[model samples]
Target: MQKLIRRREANPGVDWAEGGLHPLLARVYTGRGVAAPDELELGLGHLVLPDKLLHADRAAILLADALAADKHILIVGDYDADGATSTALAVSVLRDFGCRHVSYLVPNRFEYGYGLTPEIVELAITNGSPDIIVTVDNGISSIEGVAAARDAGIRTLITDHHLAGTTLPDAEVIVNPNQPGCEFPSKNLAGVGVIFYIMLALRAELRRRDWFAGRKEPNLSQYADLVALGTVADVVPLDRNNRILVAAGLQRIRKSQARPGIMALLEVASRSPHNVVASDLGFAVGPRINAAGRLDDISVGIECLLQHDHAAARALAAELHQKNQDRRLIEADMQQQALQLLDQITVETESAPVAMTLYQPDWHQGVIGILASRIKDRLHRPTIAFADGDAGEIKGSARSIPGIHIRDILDAVATRHPGMILKFGGHAMAAGLSIPRDAYAAFHDAFVAEVELHAEEVMLQAVIESDGELAPDDFNLELASALRFAGPWGQHFPEPVFDGVFDIINQRLVGEKHLKLVLSHPDSAQLLDVIAFNIDPQEWPNQTLSRVHLAYRLDVNEFRGRRSVQLVAEHLSAAE
Candidate 1:
């Protein structure tokens, strides 16, 4: 493990004391271009009203027309946490807005594949005969599918947060903040956030038209919990706009007034919504939602979110809980298999490049991305994992390291060997693709060549960023709460990492492979339990009283009736 501490300089334009922010926080905010106290405002008043978002009014008009005409409306959602939440939000909001003939469909990873494909559109037609289709979390990449929907005389509204392709789809309304030429400041809004914004706009439009004269004007903010869950799960950068969304959702969650499904899911996870934090959403709630998509159809997750009856919601939540556990088991097995294959290949001796491509006929297509991520973390290389699918096609997922763009590599491969790849799209760090099984070898060669051209730019070392050292006094519960409530933390705005040198006072294995340690500084000792998951004890330092440096995040762990702040170590190494 490599320790890299980058000291951030403060900006003179901001007053840290007035904002009630720590010095380190001020430095990080300044580095992230946050200038003044006003920039940190997180009140609902600061959120971008739905009317301000692009195409929101148009989407509302389209939905209103569909509702008046009693035309069937089908929602097409992606198969992920964000997509599941977006689908639920859309269904819940649309039903509240008097849309009666509405249903949702999520593409299966093993069957119809990802996004709004032609097959999915055909399935929607067969299932609902939808006169209009609304796509959540996906559709910006579905040029052909959009055309197909148009051919079927179905109006389409795309609500997505993914980067747009070169050619925009021919949808009636495109509400993506990341779309080209959109001046939305918070381009990092999740797909669910985008849909929620659309709902806000729709409600406003209804109010303007006096459409709420007899019925109640739905408070769209009530769905903020769903927005927060999706935004955190999607791993988008939590910008100012997203922070407000998550903060609002956290407020609702803390009140325990969230939807029955959300409440039930929290209960199933043994987490109290009244005390829910961002970490709970990311690790606990998000994974359960994503499990439905990864291991089975995501409709189960959407149902869990949209079901109104408490008993039904509880049952669904329990089902999703079991699915998430099954997903973990599958992921662990696949990761081990991938590692075994990687061990056979001498990455250092390979002259072509350090890029990795693995294929297993028995691998589950839904979990390939997780397996790819695991391999990439261990090897520190751009990795792609493929599984055989129906009709001789191979579905693959790619994960990239810091300096390598997996999507760009895929694009290069497609450009060099046109028609070799069936389809592919994603951001810099992650991507998905499908190819004919016979073309895998050629695609693999081209991908490796592309990665080799950029290999020097990719740093394979695990560099840990930290805020130096601090005393045990700084580990108060109040400080932990302050860190938790400071602002939304995610991909770009990372949670604070801390580092310190300590003596290993005690060590033992807990829960099979996890190592628990009691560490001590020069002045004080703390009972720190470190869980190096799946790590062998023999690989750790053997000296009984060795000095070691640790990079970790501070977390408040609650067990039984006790609450204590603990350091969750990311990396540990013997001191030089």
Candidate 2:
């Protein structure tokens, strides 16, 4: 698919340069809607007060009561990275606060699907027989599951960050920022962030009750590491509050103050804790833990996070690392198959469909989300990939582009054509659903029509937003290093990317698929190192092209203790 490198519009209201920011960075920050200098402050004090989160205090009261009464507490967690981190954070903190009977159960995706399903509730009862069920990272839509727990005489507290459906679950307390009537300023809290806030509120409740007079109080900041990992892994918007959480977590991880599990995972992923950043957590550490949930069982991930011993955590990290490797292989095979299907479909149509729905009976259920995401990025269309589910149904993982809310589309489909979609829930960019296998054609048509109705024609095309071009002097190492750390950037708050034309002094293939090149700008004679990962093998090494336009990020490449400026290419094409 073709891509357009468009520069972001500068925000005229904010003057970051006057606020003591680097001129180049000032422009970049202002372009991202930084209205004031204080917005860049990522301290813990800048985080939104926990009191503002709806039902958080109520949930805290329930947890404090459970702790004081020595009630058995069972945590129901989802099976992804966010769920694993949320469960580990909740279990670790509650235990640290002296809850002896607290334990967690993450439903296997293969057996019970998602959320606090009735089956999961029964499993929790058979296993832990708890007095209170605390759901972390999920349960916003588990209406029947909460009812089942209630019937079994167990109270439930739901802490989640997913967008709530029209009918909320009947849990005893719900602490989601996105829930109706909530006043939490930042609605983009990831599941782990929500639970962390609840724990913070719980600590305050315990403090108010004078429960910490004799017992040592746990520093909630210690769990910020977990919050950071989950928040980034889940790809939530990095608003001011989330940035604080992630920054604090990165600080702890860099200082080696994080838990053994995180350190062990970083070690296995060859990421030194001293230089860890949000992207490392997103691409490296998060994936290893998520691999267990995707391929085998998420308990391995939860257990890894819960480990206090370095050796034990390392063992589990190694196992998770293997799972991640297996998951990559599976994802690669599935992506190839999906692309082939897309090719056939394209040949039969005048233009690619505005939305895509793909199904293959043999596709791995665990890898469909990634496949959907890959296809969505490749074609710049809303894409859903389905894998065979139980009996006559198929499960799909959907990924969407900007300006197209996937969950809303799914909701519309469900509303317009009842029973076409069995169930669905998620955020703007991603969602999951199930439907009858026989309804694939009809659902595909309905989904495409919905997307066409809601999405603008411009959004259907791939547009790579850049921070414009860099000046000759701006391409130095000092600026590159500054830009690298200027952000714990991800999702809504993007890392800076720039577009410019460059003369290709050298070009070759590295690692078979990656393109490595030495290039010089027309305005400067100094050559810079550049590399583009996962480039098309057939198109690259084009000795035919001497000049090219590149959309790239200024990156600092460190090789054997030597650091230099490097350009990480986002998009490259022949310069007209």
Candidate 3:
């Protein structure tokens, strides 16, 4: 492992001390390019209102007319955590806004694959016979499917957050931050965030037209909890706009007024809503929703989010909790098998570049993407995994290192072998594709060739940024809580990681592979509990008195009836 310390510096356009932030916060904000005190304030007033978002008013108008006519409206959602949450948010808010005939359909990873495929569009037509279709977290890449919807006399409204293609989809109202002509400042809004903005605009339009004169206009802000859950879960950059959404949602969650489903999920995960943080969403709630998509039908997740009844939501949350457990077991088995396959491929003598492509006749298709991620992390190389699909076809998911773009690599393969890949689309880091089983070798070779052109790029050392060293005084509960509330942190705006040198006073193995260590810093003579999850026991140092460097994030761990600060160790090494 390589460690490079990069100092945080103020952006050229930003003022640090004059930004009216706490000293530490000012440093972090300026490092992230915040120029004014207004950028640091997370008040809802700072949020980009619906009208400020381009094409949002037009989308609201289109939706209002559809609702007035009582036309059937179908929501097409992606099969991931963000997609599920976006689907539920749109369906619930639309119904709350007086849309009489609103329903949702999520594509099965096994059958319909991903995104707004022509097959999925046809499925929606057959099942719901909708007059209009709204896509969430998907459809930006569904050029053919949008055309098909038009041909079927269905108006398409796409609300997605994915990177747009060269040719935009022919939707009646396209609400995407990544669209070429769109000038939305925050390009990191999750799919759920985009849908939430549309709801805000729709509500505004209803009020302007006196559509809800007699009835109460639903407080659309109530759904920010869902937005926060989806945005953090989707791993989008926590830009200024996204931070406002998450901060507002976290306030609702802490007040215990979050959606019943989110509350029930909190119960199942043993996390208190009153103390919910971004980590809770990423670890506890996000995985449960993602488990439904990875192992079973994602509708289970959507139901958990949409079911307003407490009893029903609890039961569904429990079911999803169990599904997540089962998913862990399945993923463990697949990962082991993948490792074994890697061991069998002997390429030591060959100068062929290292790129991973694995296909299994029995592997579950839904979990291939996750398995690809696991393999990529382990080997530090671009990885793709495929599983047998219907009628001798194979479905594959690919994940890439920081430098290589997975979708571009797949596109190059497509160009090399015309008509070989059935369908493929995604962003730079992750992608999905399908091909006949017989063409797997050709596709794999083409991908390897493309990756070889960027070998130096892929082999670059990893850069790990730290928030500098922390004294034992900084480990207090007050400082930890302040760090937690410093604003939403994910992807780009990273959660603060601290590094320090310590002596291991005590050590033990706990819960199979976890290492529990008592580390003491000499500066203040303070001892801290450090837990390294899934660490290899053989790698533990033999000398207890030896100095060691540790990289970790401070977390408040609650056990039994007590709460205390602990170090969640990410990496560690013996001090030179």
After superposition on all C-alphas, the RMSD of every candidate to the true structure, in Å, is 2.3, 1.3, 2.6
Clashing pairs in 3: none
lDDT values, one for every candidate:
0.82, 0.92, 0.84
lDDT of 2 by residue, 508-552 (tens): 999989999999989998898999999988899899999999999
What TM-score does structure 2 among the candidates reach?
Answer: 0.98
Candidate 1 structure quality by residue, lDDT tens digits, 1-576: 233544344466777776677775676577666878787888788997676678888998888778778888899998999999999999988888888888999888877887888888898888867998999999999899999999988889998887787899999999888888777777788899898888887777777778788988788888898999999988887888888888889899888778888898889899878778777889899889889988888999999899889999999999999999999999889888876776677545223256889999899888998899887776677889999986888989999988888888888888888899988988888899999999888888888888888878327554565655667677667777667667677777677777788788777777777767778776675556554555556765356557777777777778898988777777787766
> Clash pairs of candidate 1?
none
Clashing pairs in 2: none
Q: How many collisions per candidate? A: 0, 0, 0
| Residue range 452-547, candidate 3, lDDT tens digits | 887684254445667667766778877777777776777778877878788888887888789888989878677899998877677764455467
Q: Which candidate gets the maximum TM-score versus the true structure? A: 2
Misplaced by over 4 Å in model 3 are 1-25, 346-354, 455-459, 541-545
Would you estimate the TM-scores of all the predictions?
A: 0.94, 0.98, 0.93
Better of 1 and 2 by TM-score: 2
Mark the 10 consecutive residues where model 2 has the least summed lDDT.
Answer: 344-353
